[model samples]
Target: MNTFGLVIGLITLAVIGIGAFWVIRGERVLGYLWWPYFIGAGVLLMVTSGFIKNDWCSALAGVIGASLVWGATEFKEQAIRAELGWYPFGNHKKRPPFAKIIQKWKPPNL
Candidate 1:
């Protein structure tokens, strides 16, 4: 019933879609830590939802928060793609220092 939640969810989906497109095209503009940052922001938003006065506002906040948490997972998958050489490692010929940790967890063929 809350239109605001619907709007926020749609916008979140669009942003996630664009991010996925960028990753699929080998663009790593957001970097590895973006996921954790997004997840943190999402958690903050969800916590703020508890204090919101309007029902629609709270719903919107919660929806956006969930979407951001999901986005964080997508970011990790993007990192995996980058490690597998399916995606470029941004501006570096070598993986960035942040990627070194992820590289250690990469599977042999992937």
Candidate 2:
């Protein structure tokens, strides 16, 4: 019986779980303004995965990349949750560089 698909699926599930956890923590500590950087990193990982020679490695990289993209889209909502008192609000969150520029653009949602 082939277990490749099963293994990959489990790995993906794990990655997604970790992604959700990080989205909350990241937003609280780093703030949602870093969404653009997350998107760029995710896209870069996905693009770089195409050049991998090992199938397992490529699949894992793709899963992680997709999770990052999903988490990035959730950052704005995460921030809202904190503001609404649903999540712990960080008093001294790190400000993203170019904060003024980022505020002018709409953050991604999914």
* Candidate with best TM-score: 2
How many clashes show up per model?
Answer: 0, 0
Q: 1-110 in candidate 1: lDDT tens per residue?
A: 65865776787677667655744443376565544556677899999999999976787777677666666666666767787887676654334445656556532122
RMSD of each: 5.4, 0.8
Give lDDT tens digits, candidate 2, residues 4-76.
9999999999999999999999999999999999999999999899999999999998889988999999999
Clashes of 2: 0
Instruction: Write down the RMSD of candidate 1 (Cα, Å).
Output: 5.4
For all predicted structures, in order, the TM-scores are 0.55, 0.96
Candidate 1: what lDDT? 0.64
Candidate lDDT scores, in order, read 0.64, 0.94
Among all windows of ten consecutive residues in candidate 1, which has the lowest summed lDDT?
Answer: 101-110
Please give the TM-score that candidate 1 achieves against the real structure.
0.55
Worst 10 residues of 2 by lDDT: 61-70
Q: Which candidate ranks first by lDDT, i.e. highest?
A: 2
Point out where model 2 deviates above 4 Å. none
